[model samples]
Target chain A: MMPTSPVIPLFVAVPLAGAFAIALLGKKTRIIPNGMALIVTGGLIAFSIIAMRMFSLFGVHTYKLGAWPAPFGIVMVLDGLTAFMLFTVSLIAFLVILFSISYMERYSGRWQFYTLFLLMVAGMNGVIVTGDMFNLFVFLEVAAVASYALVAFGTEKHELEAAFKYAVMGSVGSLFVLLAIVWLYSYTSTLNMADMALALQAAGSTRVALVTGVLLLTGFALKAAIVPFHAWLPDAHPSAPAPISAMLSGVLIKALGVYAICRVFYSVLGVSPQLSMLLMVLGVVSMSVGVLLALRQWDLKRLLAYSSISQIGYIMLGIGIGTPLGFMAALFHLFNHSVFKSLLFLGSGAVEYATGTRDLREMGGLGKRMKLTSAAMLSGSMSVAGIPPFAGFWSKLLIIVAAVQAGYYWFAIIAVVASMLTLSYVMRIMRYGFLGELREKWAGVREVPFMMKLSLGLLALICILGGLLLLPGAREFFLTQAARTFSVGTQLASRILGGV
Target chain B: MSKERQPGMTLIVKTVTRLTVGLILLYGIYVVTHGHLTPGGGFAGGVVIALSLVHLMLAFGGDVAFKTLSKSGAAVLEAIGALLFVGIAIIGFGWAGFFFNFLPKGTPFDLFSAGIIPLCNIAISLKVGAGLFSVVIAIVFLRVAGSERE
Candidate 1:
C-alpha cells in the first residue's frame, strides 16, 4: 500500500495551496475563491476520514524527514490523538467554509479571508501532527498570526480594538510559551517532543524542569482562556463574522489552547500534582466565573463566548483528574463542546444576520420567520446547555462522574452548577431572541440562504449524535487510543523509537 | 512632500538606516547560532531579522520594499519553512532511532553538539522571519488600505 504519511500532511497542504491559488486567481474572478475554499475543505474532510481508517488499521505511524533515521531529524507522527483532532478540526472547517461562502458576501476582501483561513488550517494541522516542541510553537504562531488578521478583517472600530487586545494577549501568551520551551530545551537538551518526554522521564524532576512546567502551564492557560486569562475572548469572538466566531470558539481554542496544554503538561512535563491541582482550580474557577459572567450578557454571541469558557472548564476538569476515566471524559467533552458550542454561536450569528442586530432585547419571534435556522439554534442551545439525550449531556456527565470518582466532590458540584448557568443563559437567548413577539422592523426577514442552513444543520447533527463516538470500536479508534496515549505519557518516545 | 533639505541629509538618513539594519542582522545571526548554548533561540533571532526588514521598509517606502518582499511571497516562505521543519523531523524519526534524537552527543561541545536541533533552529529562523515580517507588512498596508479613498 502507498504510504499514508503524505496523505496526513495534505490536510494542511491542500487548504494552504487552495488559499494561495485563490488569492492569486480570485483577484481576477471572485467566484473562483469561494469554490476553491469549499472544495479544498471538503477534500480535507475526506482525508481526515482516510486518516482515521489508516490509524485504526495501522496503529500510529511516524514519518521521518528526508529519509533520515528517527532521532536524527524532524519527524511527524500520526496516531490516535492526531486522528481525533484532525477530524474535529477539518469537519468544523468544512462546515465553516460553506458558511463563509454566503455569510461573507456583505463583507469585501473575501479572498484575503480565505487566504488567512487556510494558513490557520495549515498551522493547526502542523500543531496536531508534528512530534516536536519547537515545531509546535512555530505552528502555534502560524495559526495565531492568521487568526489575528481575520479577527481584524472588518476593520470596524470595535474590530480593531478587539483584535489589538487579542493580539497583545496572544503575543504575551506565545512569549511565555517560548520562554517555557527555552527552558525545556535547555533542561532536556532536545527539541523533539517524544525525545523530550523521555528526557524528562530519565531526568526525573529537576528544579529547572519543575519551574519550566509552571511557565508552560501559565502560557497554555492563557491560550485556553481558563478563568483569569479569559478577558480577551468575549470581546474578540463577538466582533468577528458569525462563522469565524464559531470557528474561534469551537475549534481554535481547543486546537491552540486545550490540545497544546494537555500535550505539553501530560506528555512532556508528565503532569505533576501541582500541575493537576492548577488545572482543577482553573476548571472550577472558570466554570463558576465564566457562567456567572455569561448569565448577564445581552449580546447573543458574547453570552455564547462566555459559556465557551465554562464548557472548556469541564474538559480541563476531566483531564486534570489524570485517570483513564478522566482522559476519556476530557476527550469526550472536548469533541462535544466543539460541536455544540460552534452550533450555538452560528445560531446567534444567524439571528444577527437576519435581524441586523446582536442584542437579545432587539430580537423577537424569529422562530416563525426562520424555522430551519431557529430550529438549529434551539437544538444547539439545548445541546450546549447539557440537556439529556444530547451530546453535551453525556460528556458533562462523564466529567462530573470522573471528578467525583477522583475525590474532587467540590469540583464536581461546580461542574453541575455551571451546567445550570449554561442552561439559564441559553434558555434566555431562546426566549428573548427567538420566542418573543416579532419586531415590526424584522417583519420581512426570512430564513438564511442554503449555505448557512447547511452548515448549521451539519453542526446541529453532530451536537446531538457526538456521543456515538464513545461506542466500542469507534472509541478505540478515536477517544480510547488518544486518551491512552496521554495516560501512557513518557512512554511515547519508547513506543515511536521502538517502531523504528 | 517637502523637498527643501540640507545638503546630504538624504545621504545621512540612508547611511544611518543601513548601519542600524546591518547591526540587527549581525545580532540575529549571533543569537540564532548560539541558541542552544546561550539565551535566545530561533524565535528571538528571527524577530530581529524581521525587524531589519521593517527598518528597510520605513527608510525607503512601503511600495518600494513591499514589491521586493510582498505579502504573498512572505506567506509562501512561511509555509516552506514550516514544511522544511516537518521534513527534517521525519528524517530524524526514521534514522535517529527516536523522533528528534541526534547522532550520539557528538563531541558534546562541538558545532553540532545539539544534533538536529540547530537545523530546526535555522528552519524556525526562516519561519519567524517570514511570519513576523508578514505581520508587520500586513499591519502597515492594512492601515493604508483602510484610510485611502477609492
Candidate 2:
C-alpha cells in the first residue's frame, strides 16, 4: 500500500524555519543557536527513523503539495531509497552539528554558521524528498550556495581562494544540470521525475534522452568529485572548518551527486549497458587515483579529502554492476562510508582542535594523551580501510564478490588492489600522525571539549557496530529495501504514479 | 562649492533622487499587491522595492541609507520576511496540505482577492528588498574595510 503522510513536507519545512529562527534570535543569546541546532537536528533524526519504518511497512509514501494530484503539482516521495538517504543525511548532520558546537567556537559568527548549516540540511532534505526534477536542482543550489559560504567562513587567504574555485566549478556543474533539466523538459513536457520516466519510457531511448543523460552525468559527476572533475575538493574540503569538512565529505557528495546519478540513470533514464560500463570505468579510476594522491599528502584533512574520492569510487563501482546484489552493496557501502568518513573527519577535527595544526610532520604520539580520539581515529581508519569486522570491509567485500559473480573479474581485481592501497595510506596517517612518539611542542594538548568528544565517541561507536547493519534481519529492513528501488528500474514510475 | 565637497553625487542628482525615490517605492508596492492579476509578482516587485533603497544609497552616502535601515535592521527584516512566507505555508499545511493556498480566491481583478498571495507577495518583498539592500551594504562595507587596510 502507498500511504500519504502529512509529515513528509516537514522534512524540508522544519529546518528551513529553524534556519531563519536562528538568523533572527541567534544574536540575542549564545545558547539559543546551540539549543536550536541540537533540537532541529535531533528532531530530524527521529523523524527520519520513523520515515524508514513507515517505508518498510507501507512500501512507498508520497505527499502532494497544495492537495494537488501527482503529475500536476509537486510531490514529496518517501520510498525505501529516499528513506535510506534521509536517515544517512540526518544522522550525519546531527553528529556534525554536535561537533560544531565546540569546534566552531574558534571562529566568529556562530549565528551565521548555524543558519547556513541548517539551511544546507534543509536543502539536502528537500533534495532527498522531492519528486520533482527541477525542485531537486533548486534544492541542490540551496545546499551548494550555503556550503560555498561556509567554506569561506574563515576568511583566510587559502580558504577564500579555495571557496572561489569551488564556487566557480560548482556553478559550472549547476549550469549543466539546469541545461539537462531544460532538455528533459522540452523532450517530455514534464519536470516531475515519475512523469518524465513514464514519458521517456514511452518515447524510448531517443537521441534527446541520451544527450540529457550525458549532460546530467557530467554535472553530477562534478558534484560527486569523480576523479577527472575533482580539482576543487582537495582544496575546498580541507579549507573549510572541520565540521563543515565532515558534512562535505560524509553526506553532501552522496546526497547531491551519487544519489542523483542513481535516481536519474536507473529510475528515470533506464540505464543502458554503455552507461554502466562508463560508471565502472569512472569508479575504478577514481578509486586508484584518489588513494595515490592521498599517499603523498602530509596535511591530515587533505589526505582524508583525497581518501573520500577513493571511497566514493567503491560506491560507484558497486552501482555500476547493475545487479540486485550490486545495488545492495552500493547502498550498504554508501551508508557505511557516511558513518566512518564523517567519524574520521571529526577525529581529525579533534586533533586540529587540540594541536592547532593539520600537518602530519608536526604531530606525533598524541594517542596516549587523547585516548578517545585516537581510538575513534583507529576505528574509523580500520573501517575505511576495509579491515575485518568493520562496516567498510563487508560492503567492499560484497561489491567485489558481486563483481566477480557478474563475471567482471578485472573490475574485481581492481577493487581489491584499491582496497590494499586504501590500507597503505590509512596506515601512513596512523604512523605519522598518531602512532609515533609524542612531540615536545604538543605536550600540553588535552582531549577536546566534552561536546566534541561525545560526538566523536558516538560516531566511532557506530563505526564499530555498523557491520551489524548487514546482518540478515537488518539487511532486509534497510539495504534490501533500498536496493530494490534501483532494481525495479523504470517500473518505479508505475509504482509511484499507480500508487497515487 | 561647499555642496560639491559632500561625499555624494552632485546636488542635482541628490535632489532628483529625493523627488523620485518615494515614487519608486510606491510603484514597487503596487507591483507586489497586484502580482496575482498582473505579470509582475513577488520577485519582480521585490527587486523594484530594493532598487528604491539602492537609489537612496547611491544618491547620498551609505550613511544616509544606514540611518533609514541599518545592516542589522535589514538582517532582521530579511529573517522576518522569510518567516512570514514560511508561516503562511505552514498555516496552509495546517488548514489543508502544504502550500495548499487555504485562503479564499475572491473576485478576479479585485484588490483584496487572491487570499494569501498578496500576503505572500508582501512577505517576499520584505525579504528580497532587505536581502538585496543588505547585500549591497555588505559590498560597500567590504570596500571600506579594504580601503582601511590599504
Candidate 3:
C-alpha cells in the first residue's frame, strides 16, 4: 500500500515559488534570477530523487491538499510513473539552466527567461503529479503559456511567427482538452482521476466516453506533435532559443502529451484493443512521416524538430502494443529519447552560439574548432541513431523486440526502417556540419563557454551510458516499476481509491 | 499652455479620471475582501482593479500613469501576489496538510471568515490586477520600442 506523504506537493511548489521570486527580485541584479533558477532546479532534482526513493520504499504516496479526502479536495500522487517523469523533467531542466547561464547572455531580459523557464518546470511537475483531470488542464495551460512566450523570447520575425502559430495550435488543443474534461466530469460526476476511473468503470463504456476519449486523444496528440497534428512543431521548435527547444523536445511532449495519454487511457478509462490499435496506427504514421520530412531539412534545428516527432512516434508505437514489455520498452525509449534529444538540441545551440548559424550547410569542419561540441554531437547522433552500446540502440532494440513479441512483425519492420531513416539524417547532419573542410567564413570560430560545454558533456555522458538502465537491478527498480503502473491498467483506480 | 500642460489626454478626460479612479480601486478592494462571502473573488476583483489602473493610463497617458506603477513595479507586485498566494498555501503545511485551512472558521458572511479564503482572494486580486496592468504596459510601451527599432 502507498502512504500519504506531504513531499509530493513540493514538486510543484518549489519551482513556482522560485519563478515568482525570480520575477520579483531578479531585476535587482542579473545574477539573482539565474542563480535562483539553478538553486530551485537543483532542489527539485533532490526532491524528485527523494520522491523516487519514497515510491520504491513505500508503494505509492498521495498528498491531499487542505487535508481533505481524495474524492473531495485536490490530491497529488507519486507513483513510479510520476517519480520517473519528475526525475526526467528536473534533470533536463537543471542541466539546461546550467547551459543557459552563459548561453543566455546573448539575449537581454535574462530574468524574464528564468522566470518563464521556472514556470514551465513548475507546470510540468504539476502535470506529472496532479490527480485531477481539470487540474491537469490547468497545469498544461501554465506550461503552454510560458512556453509560447519563451519561444518568442527572441522577438525576431521568424520567432514571432512561429510562436504565434504554436500558440494558436496549442490554444485550440487546450480547448479540446477542456471540452473533454467537461465531458468526463459530466459523465462521471467527478473530477478526480482515480474517482473518475471508478465512475467510468461503474458506468461502463458509453458514446459519451468514446467521444471524450477521442477528444482527449486528439488534443494530446497535437501537443505531442504526432503526425496528423504536427504542423506547428517544426517551425516552433526551430524558432525557439535552444534551451527552450531542448525543454520542449525533451520532456514537454512526454510529460504533457504522451504521459497524459497514457494515464487517461490506461488508468482512467481502461485500455481496449481498438484504442491500442489506434495508438499503433498513429505511432507508425507519425514515425514514417516525421522521418521522411526530416530527411529533407537542411536547417539543423528543424531537422532535430522533425526527428523529435519521429522519436515520439516510436514511444507511441511501443505503448500502443499494450503488453507489459511494450510498455516498458516505450518508457525506456522515452527516457533515452529525452536525453539524446536534449543533447542534440544543446549541441545545435552550441554550434549556433559559436557560428551564429543553424543551417547545416553553413557549418563545416566545426569539429576542428569546437572539439567538445563535435564530440557531444557525435555522441548524441550515435545514441539517437540507435548505434550499438549507446542508450538509443537498446531502447530501439527493445521496442522492436517487443513489437515482434506482440506478433506485429510489420510494425517491427517499420520501426527498423524508421531507425535506418533516423541514422541517415543524423549521419547527413554529421557529414555536412562537422566532418567536411572548415568554412572560410567560420575561420575565427571558437568553442562555447565552459558552462555550455559542461552541460553538453553531462548529457553526452548520459547518452553514452543510457544503456546501463537496462541492467537487471536497475531495470526492475526503475523501468519495470514505471511500466507496471500502466500494466496494471484500470486496477490503479481501485488501488488509489481504496487507500491504505 | 504648452509649457504648463501635463502629458496626458484632454484636461476634461484627465479630470474625470482623477475624480473616479480612486473609487474604482476601492470597489475592487471591496470585492476582493468580500470574496469569501460574495460571488466576486480574486480574479474578478483583480481584473476590476487592473482596469482602473488601465483607466489611469488611458486617460493620463503612459508617462503620468507609469509614475504610479512602472512596468517593473507592476511585475514586482504580480510576483509578490503570486508568492503571497503560494506562501499561504504552504503555511497550510504547518497546520494540517498542504493548503489546509488552519484558521478558525468564524461565523459565515463575516468580513474575516473562511480561514485563508479572504487572504487568498487578496493575493489573487493583487496578482491579476498587477499582471493585467503590466500586460497593458508591455503592449503599450513595446509598440513604442518596436517602432524605435525600425
Candidate 4:
C-alpha cells in the first residue's frame, strides 16, 4: 500500500482559504484579489501535478481526515482518475482565473467574483477528491451554489432570469442527489463509498438499489445537462460573464455531471447492461438534439452552450460503450473538450469584449482585426469540429472506433453524423462571425489584452497538442491508468478499501 | 423619543427586543461552546446569534443595526470566521494529519473538553452568525432601496 501524501487535502484547503482571504483583504485594494486568485490557482496546478506524480508512483493513496479510520471518518482518495480530474480542473481554473484578470474589469465587485471563483474551485476539487458519498454531495452543492451566484453576477434582467432558472433546476438536481445519498446511507448504513460498495454487493441488486440508481442518474444527468435536462444550460452559460462562461462550460459541468456519473455508476453502483444502453441512448439524443439546436442560435455564447451538450453526448456514447477503449476515449474526449471548449468560450468573450455584442450577424470579418483571438477561435473550432490532426478528431475517432468494435455499428453511424453536425454549426460561427466582410462599425476593433490572449494562446496550444496524450508512452502513463480504475468495475471497492 | 416617530416599530416591540436580544446572544454562545455535549452546535447556535441581531434590526431599524454591527463589519467577521475554521484544520497538518485533533482532550462533559471541537464550533458559529446577518442585511437593504425608488 502506498503511504498517504500530505498534499492531497491542500487541493480543497488552499482554494477555500484563498477565497476567504480574498473576501477579507480584497476590499482594501483591487490587486489583492487578483494576486490572491493567481497565487491560489497557480498553487493548485502545482499541487495537482504533484498528485498525478504521486498516483503514478503509489497507485492509490487515501487520506483519512482527523486521523480517523475508513468507514468511520471522511477519507480523501487520490488515484489515477482523481489525479486526472484534478489536473484538468486546476489547469482550466488557472487559465480562467488568468483570463478573468482582464475580462472581469467591465463588471463591478471584482473581489466578489474572485471569491466565488475560488469557492467554486474548492468545491470542484473537494468533489473530485472526496471518498465519502455524503461528502461528495456537500462539495457538489458548494460548486453548484457558487456557479449559481456567478451566473447572476451581472444582475441584468436576462442574467437574473437565467440565474433564477439555473438555481431552481440545480436545486432540484441537488435535492435528488441528497435524497439518493440518504437512501444509500440507509441501505448500507455507511457513507464511505468503498464500504457501501461492498455492502451493496453483499445485498445484491434489489428494488431499493434500482430506485437509488434512477435517482442518482436523474440528479447527475440534470447537472450534466444531458439532452432533456439541458434546458437551463443555454440560458445560464450565456448570461454569465465570459470567463465565467468558459469556466461553466469548460469544467463545471464535466466535474459535477460527467465525473459524478462515471464514479457513482462504474465504481459504486456497478453498471449493468441496461444502464449502459440507457447511457448510450442519452448520449446519442443529446448529441443529435444539441447540435441541431445549435445550428439555429445567433448568439455566439448560446451556440457554444448548445455545442457543449452535443460534445457531452460524444463522451456519454464513449462511456456507455463500456469497453476499455471506450473509457479511454471518453476520458480523452472529455479532456480535449475542456481545453478547446474553454478556448472557444474565451474567444467568444474576446469578441464580445471588443465589439460589445454577441450576435453572430453583427460580428463580421473579425479575423482581420483581432488576429490573435480569431486564430485561437479557429484552432478551437477546428479541434471541436474534429478536423484531422486536432485533439477533437482523435477522441471522436476513438469513440466511433470503440463503438464499432463493440458491435454497435448504428451508434457509430449516429456518432459520425453528430460529428458532421458539429462541424456544420462550428463552421457557421466561422463564416458569420469571422470570415465575412468587416463591419463598418467594427473598424476600430483590436485584439484582446495580453493576459486574455496569453490564456487563449495557451489553451489553443493544448488543443493542438491534446492528441499527443494518446502517444503510447503517455497513453500508458495517463489514460490507461484512469481507464483501468473503471475497467475493474466493482472490484474498485476492494482496491480502495485495501489502501486502508 | 415618541413611539410613532421612531425609525422602526412600536415602543413595546423595541422594549421587548432590547430585553431579549442580549439573552439570546448569550444563549447562542453557550450553545456553541457546549456543542460537543448538547444537541445544538455551531449551525444552530450561529442562527440564534444572527437572529439576535436580526431581532435588533427588525425592532429598532437599520440605523440601530448599523451602529451595532455594520454591513462591512458582518462581512469581515464572516470572512474571519471562515479563515479561522480553515486555519485550524490546516494547522493540523503539522501534527498527525489534516483536521487531526491535536489539542489535549480535557474531560468528557466538561466545557473545555473535546479538544478542537469547541474551537471548530466557535469558528463555525462566528462564520454562520456573521454570514446570516450579512445575508439578511443585504436583502433588507435591497428591499429598502427598491421601495424608496418608488
Per-candidate DockQ versus the true complex? 0.09, 0.84, 0.87, 0.94
Residue pairs that clash (backbone atoms under 3 angstroms), model 3: A2-A60
Q: How many backbone clashes does candidate 4 have?
A: 0
* Tens digit per residue, CA lDDT, model 2, A1-500: 45898878988999999999999999978899999999999999999989989888888899998878899999888888999999999999999999998998898899999999999999989988999999999999999999999999999999999999999999999999999999999889998899999999998779988999999999999999998999999999999999999999999999999999998888788989999999999999999999899989999999999999999998999999989999999999999899999999999989999988899988889897899999999999999999989888899999999999999999999999989989998898889888889988888889999999999999988888988988898999988999999888888888889988
Model 1 residue B51 distance off true place after TM-score fit, in angstroms: 11
Backbone collisions counted per model: 26, 0, 1, 0
List ranges where model 3 is wrong by over 4 Å: B1-7, B143-150
For A1-500, candidate 1 gives per-residue lDDT tens digits of 21336676566556666766665567656688888888888888888888888977877787765545566666677877788899899888888888888888888888888888988888888888887788899999999889988889999999999999999999999999999899888777888887887888887778877788777777777878888999999999999888888888989888999998877776677877877888888888888899999999999889989998988888888888988988898898888888888888888777777888999888888898989888888888888888978888888898888988989998888888889888999999899888978889989998888989999998888877877877888778778877887777767677877777
How do all models score by TM-score? 0.83, 0.99, 0.98, 0.99
Ranking by DockQ: 4, 3, 2, 1
Q: Model 1 - which docking category? A: incorrect
Off by over 4 Å in 4: B1-4
Give the winner by DockQ.
4
Interface RMSD of each: 7.0, 0.8, 0.6, 0.5
Top candidate, metric lDDT: 4
What lDDT score is found at residue B67 in candidate 2?
88
Local accuracy of candidate 3 as per-residue lDDT tens digits, A86-201: 99999999999999999999999998899999999999999999998899999999999999999999999999999999999999999999999998998888999999999988
Ranking by TM-score: 4, 2, 3, 1
